[model samples]
Target: MALIECKDASFAYEGVSVLEGVDFSLNAGDYLCIVGENGSGKSTLVKGLLGLKKPESGQILYGDGLKSTEIGYLPQQTMVQRDFPASVYEVVLSGCLNSLGRRLRYGPAERERAESNLERLGIEDLRDKSYQALSGGQQQRVLLARALCATKKLLLLDEPVTGLDPIATGEMYNLIKLINLCDDITVIMVSHDLHEAVRYATHILHLGRRQLFFGTSAAYRESSLARRFLGRDRI
Candidate 1:
């Protein structure tokens, strides 16, 4: 079964429609990239999928043992968030808070998971480091570890490489690709980098002002939408 399905989904803010009649499905181990122009409701669609916003019409279905709260999320960072006062371990361990319910302390299992994620990201050495003292790339890796502590089934990333230099951006993409392919985690990403999207994603969902395109990456490369917006350039 599909991990997540959107049937005729639509969203609005203050009654002004931002997305309408959107339909899609995400399967296990699929890397789905959502791309669009500004104001095309890419972020809104993600909010709807995450259940942070109620769709104006239609339904979002979750199957294959997936729950709304079990999905890991890596949001776009702000300057203030980049300078947050905390240790890397502290931030990552907090991701288990959702599973703790009313508990005040983390269990041994949660701690193990956090440490395992840190090691998986090859940032075990930075566990005790101050979050603000790390480079931009390291900071993003820490955040990814935090998100992994939340779930192993699925990850939602929004503009994860927004502020990094090209080298950092490439590293981040490689990390995410490894997580998706090796860890077998389904990835749903909101990205503006069309070139990288085509390179990394297995499937593409392109949202225009009033149009939608969904298909395999190879097929998307041949669509008029890709030709018009992305052009023939591979970069």
Candidate 2:
């Protein structure tokens, strides 16, 4: 079964429609990339999917036993977030907050999970370092580790490589691909880089004012829609 399905989903803010007639299915282990122009409602669609905002019409179904709390999210960073005053360990462990329910403190399992994620991201040595002291790439790795503490099933990333250098961006993309391909996690990402979208994503959801295309990346490469928007750039 599909992990998530959006059936004619539409979203609006203060009754001004931003996205409409969105339909798609994300199967388990699919690396789905959402691509569009700046004002094409990509972020708004993500909010609707994450239940941070409700759709104005239609349905978003979570199948394959998926739940909102079980999905990991790495949001776009702001200047304030970049300078957040906290230890790496503290920031990573906070990903467990949603799953803590009424608990006042983290249990052993949560700590273990946090540590494991740190190791997985090759940042275990930096666990005690101050978050604000790290470089942009290091900060993103810490955040990814934090998100991993939330779930192993699915990950949602919004422009994860936005401000990094090319080397850092490539490293981040490889790490995300490892999570999707090796760790067996499903991925849904919102990205503006069409080149990276074509190179890394298995499925593409190209959103215009509406959903212009939704299909496998291979299909998108052959479609006229891709031609018009992306030109004839080879993946």
Candidate 3:
């Protein structure tokens, strides 16, 4: 069964349609990369999926089983996060806050999950380190570990590799690929790196000014529009 299903979804701001007639389905283990220009409504679509914004028309369904918070999200790190004075362990443990049962303390399961996520991401040694003291790649991994502490079912990433160096970018993509491909988790990510997306993603969701294209990576490579925008050899 599909994990997420969208039917004829459209989102508007002040009656100005940003996304129109969008439809897509995501299954477990599917990795879909979202591609578009600056004003192509990629974030808006993400917001809609996150339930932060309601679509003006149509429906969005999450398999009638997953909780809203179960959709793990790794947003682009901003300047605010870079300067935050929290330990990496503290930040990761925060992912367990929402799942707590009105308690004022961390349960054994929550702590174990956080620790496991950090260990899985190879940041167990940095658990006591300050968040701001880590390098850009380490910071990204910490945030991902935090997200993974919540759930491994559905993952959403928004421009997660923006300012990182090439090696960091490659490593981050490889981690995400492992989560989606090896762990059987579903991924819906917004990416500016067409080359990485083409190499890793099984499906591509392209958003234009007022249109959307949903297809497999090979199908996107065959389209003239995708070829023009994403480049011929790039895909």
Q: For candidate 3, what is the TM-score?
A: 0.96
TM-scores of the models, in the given order? 0.97, 0.97, 0.96
- C-alpha lDDT score of every prediction, in listed order: 0.91, 0.92, 0.87
Residues 1-235 of candidate 1 have per-residue lDDT tens digits of: 8999999888889999889888989899999999998999998988888889999989999999898888899988978877789999999998887789888899999999999999999999999999999999999999999999998799999989988999999999999999999999999999999989999999999987443799889999998888888877753
Q: Using alpha carbons, what is the TM-score of model 1?
A: 0.97
Q: Is candidate 1 or candidate 3 better by TM-score?
A: 1
- Could you list the CA RMSD of all candidates, in the order they appear? 1.1, 1.0, 1.3
Report the lDDT of model 3 for residue 107.
90
Which sections of candidate 2 miss by over 4 Å?
Answer: none
Per-residue C-alpha lDDT of model 3 across residues 1-235, encoded as one tens digit per residue:
6789889899999999988877999887889999988989899988988889999999888884876678788887878999899999999999887688689999999999999999988999999999999999999999989888777688888998889999999999999998887788888899977778878999999888545678888887888877887777765
In the predicted model 3, the residue pairs found to clash are none
Per-residue C-alpha lDDT of model 2 across residues 125-233, encoded as one tens digit per residue = 9999999999999999999999899987889999999999999999999999999998989999999998889889999999987899999999999999888777775
Query: Which stretches of candidate 1 lie above 4 Å from their native place?
Result: 233-235
Ranking by lDDT: 2, 1, 3
Give the deviation of candidate 1 from the true structure as CA RMSD: 1.1
